[model samples]
Target: MRTSTFLMSIIVLVAIMCKNVVNGAIAEGGWMTYCQDKTKAPEGALFACFRSNDGGIHYNGRDLTSSVIYSNPSKANEIAVVLQGHGASAKFWTNDHTVQVYVKDGSSVNYSIKPRQGEGRVNSSVYSSSDADVVIGK
Candidate 1:
């Protein structure tokens, strides 16, 4: 009976997990795939962006549209990205950018950028997209 209960519990847990993943609960924000190498960028480098009509200048890419245009989405309705070097740096487009790429040392973690804090690159500065950061995994 104990073994049966344990197996049933495990099955239930797995079912719930699967349900969440399929229903987008586990992926509440959104899923996006970005290629570092433009040469390898899937044909047009298309993606998505999103926005909030009620908010003030809150827009994030909701979907991919065309070449040189990656319409990336975010978990929050107004997910704004600011690629420092990619943009003019003079100002950040509250509803215009997708994701910002920053440069730092080689001591950063995979998912978190805490250890590499206060560290800067010899050529540029470190940037991130809130918690949705993408670092070069070496």
Candidate 2:
């Protein structure tokens, strides 16, 4: 009886996890896949961005569009990405807010909900590396 109870508990936990993954609980805010090589971006780039809408989730090169076009202007070899809540920056953010990309040249780019389109706005800036860590947030 104890073994049966433990097995039932494990099954329940697995079911909940599977449901969350399928329902975008893992993607509640948004997610991005970066180009391993920034020099060849948006070209043969295995990239995807997501934004949740009332209608449903919109993906880059699909339904949602990015106003901030990513070009490796500095010719950096790799790009650093920060999901809205996953960064070590001090920024005010809500769920489903923004994604931030950083390059080594003290430059940063932010992607957030379009104005009046969803829930937040993109505020991007540049500062000395000592003063602030590279960050992207809504």
Candidate 3:
């Protein structure tokens, strides 16, 4: 159907544009950068629960381990983000079943409800535990 095709194209275009803004070609360990986990994610990863928002990458344990944004989760307080940047936390609080992201200028975007029961490819570092294994060692 022409209408279906058109809608698909529009969604694709939006995704592309958002990626350009979020990616910004920032690599591993770069501040304000984005990285994707396009495969099986580790259990207990914050990003594992954040695959719905645009240009959003789960801040990996590796990155957090280095404390690029802070000396440690308990040390230097590093939190420069908008609503869009905290979609995961918002989801936990609102229970609206949608992910919302806020940009530096206060622009916000919302993604549809994920249903919390879908199987999609995510970065291997997304979860702290999947089903049987511990992603981050203790």
Candidate 4:
């Protein structure tokens, strides 16, 4: 009887975890790369940028769209610009780390990622339909 009870408890725990993942309550740490500019920056630093898709979830329990930029080779310094909306598109500057992101809800954001700064951090900005575009550089 004790063994049966333990097995039942384990099954219940697994079911709960599965439910959270399916409902987008848990972050899978997966991102889809939208653009990668191989061009080198000043001081011979290389940078790569990525944008999140519809599967991402924000900390506030809303749909997430983000642009992540990191230093190449080491990836020691990184920055993330996130927005709370669906449908995101990214455009990168030629031979530079600057990127502009456009959200489907008539919202857009831009950022410039620096190299060898420190740990990665997320910068969240709020926007309304009237805002149209937002820029957050460096």
Model 2: lDDT to the true structure = 0.33
lDDT of 3 by residue, 7-100 (tens): 9999999999988755432223321221222233222122212322222223433323212221122312222111223322222212222222
Cα lDDT over the full model 1: 0.30
Which candidate has the top score in TM-score? 3
Tens digits of per-residue lDDT for model 1 on 1-138?
999999999999999997864443112222343322223223322222223233223323432111122233433433322221222211112232222322123221111112123343322233322233232212
lDDT, model 3, position 25: 22
Better of 2 and 3 by TM-score: 3
Model 3 C-alpha lDDT versus the unseen true structure: 0.29
Candidate 1 stretches greater than 4 Å from native: 14-26, 29-70, 73-125, 130-138
Q: For each candidate in the order shown, give its overall lDDT on alpha carbons.
A: 0.30, 0.33, 0.29, 0.35
RMSD to the true structure for each prediction, in A, is 16.4, 15.8, 17.1, 14.1
lDDT of 4 by residue, 2-93 (tens): 99999999999999997874434212232221122222122211112343321221222232244333222323222233333245433433
TM-score of 4: 0.22
TM-score pick, better of 1 and 4: 4
Q: How would you encode candidate 2's per-residue C-alpha lDDT over 86-127 as one tens digit per residue?
A: 222222222344333332222333333333336555544533
CA shift at 64, candidate 4, in angstroms?
15
